[model samples]
Structure formats: structure tokens, C-alpha cells
Target: MPSSSGRPNNNLLRALSAQDYELIRPHVRCETKAAGELLYRPGDHVGSAYFPCGPSLVSYEVTDGDGRNVETVLVGREGAVGGIVSLGFLPAYCLIVVKFDGPFVRVPIVNIQSAKDRSPSFKNMFARYADCLMAQMFQSTACNAIHSIEQRTAKWIAAAMDRTGENLVPLTHDQLAAMLGVGRSYTSRVLQAFRQEGILTTRRGALIVDDPDKLRLRACRCNEAVKEHFDIVLRGVYPEPDDAAVA
Candidate 1:
């Protein structure tokens, strides 16, 4: 949800200079989204940009013709999905899916482009955010190629917890398989092992972290690397949920 100050809780928006914030403030509209919802699909024009708030998590995935998708990037309060680098409404190259239930502030692409055109600082901020997003994409590719599924699973679980700011993340093995681009049985097996090791516990469709420090040890280092890059490119734009948002 947006804060009472009328500014979005999203780090990028909160980081905006007062002058730049006002330029786009009137156009921002906050809306709620459910898990498993698709914000945009490949071939669909991106009509708006979404900045997720606490409890909101979006995934950018490369979709195949067969309708399967593998996540390339994760966006939360720290970033936006859709219409960031584009000058106007354009077909999305990847599908954007919300994996958590929460609110997001969306602004039309035209407004975003207009805001950028009118404010040099705004344009520069968008450019830096886009670069930081690209860094996530690159790191994700390498992490998938080099890391074991156990480690990668831990990474994404930790990421989801970070984004949602919850000790309990509502996700099922099937959902995670799609993101990890693995077989459902494989994901189930991995998850079962985690439970056996007392890393986490699951009930219904949610996962509760038991020993986060141990879970962090099982994760690949890509998350830290991506966070460092974001801190460098868009200082304070990456949500430090571990400290600021986590319960």
C-alpha cells in the first residue's frame, strides 16, 4: 500500500526528488493484485508500469511457445515491471506474473514517458533502474547455469521472503517449479529434503522459514551480487527487506 504521505512505498518512487515525484504523482493509481495473476504476456503491449509494495512480488519470465516460462528477474518495492525502458507502449518480451497478493501503484506508459521527457533527473533515474534490472537478468542466467537446484531453490525462497516481508511465504511446489524451470517432482523432492533438515516447514500452500541463516548458507551468492549492483546504481532503491520490511 502507498504511505499516508501520498507517495508510494516503492523505493524508486520514495527516492525520487520532490520535483520529479510531483511530475508523476497525480497519475499514479494503486491497485491490488492476486497471486498467479499475469500483468503482461509476451506479444501483449505493456500499457502500464507496476511498482509493487510490501506483500507484492512480480516475476519477469521468458515464455516459450508451449506456454512454459522461466523467471528471469524478480521485482518488488525496489523496482518496477513493464514500460521502464520503452519509450511507448510496446509488446512485452516476457510475461510479468505476480506471485503474491498485495497492492501496486501503476501509471500509464504515456505518463511515464511524458514524465521522463519533462524531467532530466527522472529520465536518469529510470535509466539507472533499468540498468540495475538488467544486472539481475544477467546474474540470474549465470546462477541457473552454475548453481545446484538446492542452492537455487534456497535463493528464490529467500528472495520471496525478502520481497513479501513475511516469515511465511505462500507458494507451492508447482509454482516454484515454473519459476525454477524444473520438474514438479524434482522441486517436491528438494522441498521435502528442506523440511527434513528443519530448514523450513510447509502447510497448505505456504512455506515458513525455520532457520533463515542456514537457508541463506544454502543459497548461491547471486542475490548478494545483484543487491550490491543495485546499491551502486540506484542507491537505496533496492528494498532491504531483511532489515526494513521483514517481521
Candidate 2:
């Protein structure tokens, strides 16, 4: 299992069967993931796959008519990024943008795919994770279309909190607006509403959740669904809760 440094509070790696983990051990490389960093963009070759030791925000950007770009999904520690198109030579439809600062375990794409072929148990576990990713992406689409900005913002905040395991989320209104696909003014208004409700506290450029449950209540179903899926899918695959807790 990976040490508790710059890693997300997840049980997946630790929960892995020893034999399965050993197969991929040699290929797991640690790297820094800072906020506002871009991992890969459209047309960039998928060289590595990253699993967060901490929370990260990976967004998929798609250009619409008139060339306006919008985010499709926000990937955090709940799922590994850059694995979908890694084997398929499909051009990227989205960009992986880091939302929080932390460390992540990176494996070369080829190595990861090769490990999948070499280890059946590991392949099954990774495939399950892929399903969770699909669920999140689907939920995001629904949340974007049907939920209010305040509700969606709450969902986003909750997701970040889960990934980073911190209340102080370092994100700006402009960035949030971009991720949420809303006007900057609209994001500001929604944030003010959240602040008034005591669900969040906003400073100059960052936000801190004052009450997690309150945010959960305000969030769309997507927030809960994603967490539930992760819990269900990653169940026996990660270490026990007592064991995976970060130091």
C-alpha cells in the first residue's frame, strides 16, 4: 500500500489483495498535483494515469457551437483520471484540470494497461472503478441540467470536501463559475446565498464549508450518489477504514 503522503483518504489501494497490489507496485510513481494545473488537454497523448492520494478536480472541456467551452465532469479521488482514452487512440474530448493541491500516484498508461493484462483481480477492481466514473459523469450531466446553481454549488463543495478531507477549499468564484457552467455574476449570487445560509464561508478567493450536512442538504442528488457509488464499488478493494485513514 502507498504511504499516507499527499494521498487521498481512500481505501482502494490498501484494500487490494496483496498479490494484486504487488503486480502494480513497481509502476506506481508519486507526483505533485497542484490547483489550477492542467494534466492533459485535447490532442495530448495520454502518457500517465493518476490516482489521487488527496482530492483533485479533473474536468472535461468540450467546445460547443460558437466555440464556447464548458466542463462536463469533475473527477476527484473517487476515480482515477486519464484511463479511458489511454488505450483507445481517441482524441480527448475533455481536459484534466487539477482543482486541489496534493500528491498523486501516477503510473505510465502502458504499464497500467499491461498490469491489467497480467493480473485478473487487479483488472476487475480497476474495471469496477471505471463503472463508478461512468456513474459520476452521468450524475454530473443530470445535475447540470436539472439542479439550481446553489444546489449544484453545494454538490461541488461537498465533492471537494470529500476529496481533500478539508473544510477550506481553495477555489475562486471565476473558476467555480467555469466548472459549474454558469455566469460569474450568477456564481457570485449563489455563493452569497450559501454564505447567508451558513452553509459556507467565503473569503477573498477561497471557500470554507461551515457545515457539511447543510451543504449536503443544499446539494443535488449527485453528491450523495457519487459517494455511495464509490463506497459500494470500492468496498472490499481498499483497506479497512481504520487502516486507510490518513495520518
Best by lDDT: 1
171-245 in candidate 2: lDDT tens per residue? 899988877778899989988988888988989889988988888888788766776777788754322212222
Expressed as tens digits, the lDDT of each residue in 52-149 for candidate 1 is 97668899988777988999898888888988987767799878999887889999999999999999999999999989988998999999999999
lDDT of 1: 0.86
Model 1, C-alpha of 8: deviation from truth (Å): 1.9
lDDT of each: 0.86, 0.71
CA shift of 63, model 1, Å: 2.0
Cα deviation of 169, candidate 2, in Å: 0.9
Residue pairs with backbone atoms closer than 3 Å in model 2 (clashes):
7-53, 7-54, 8-53, 8-54, 11-238, 14-239, 15-238, 15-239
Top model by TM-score, which number?
1
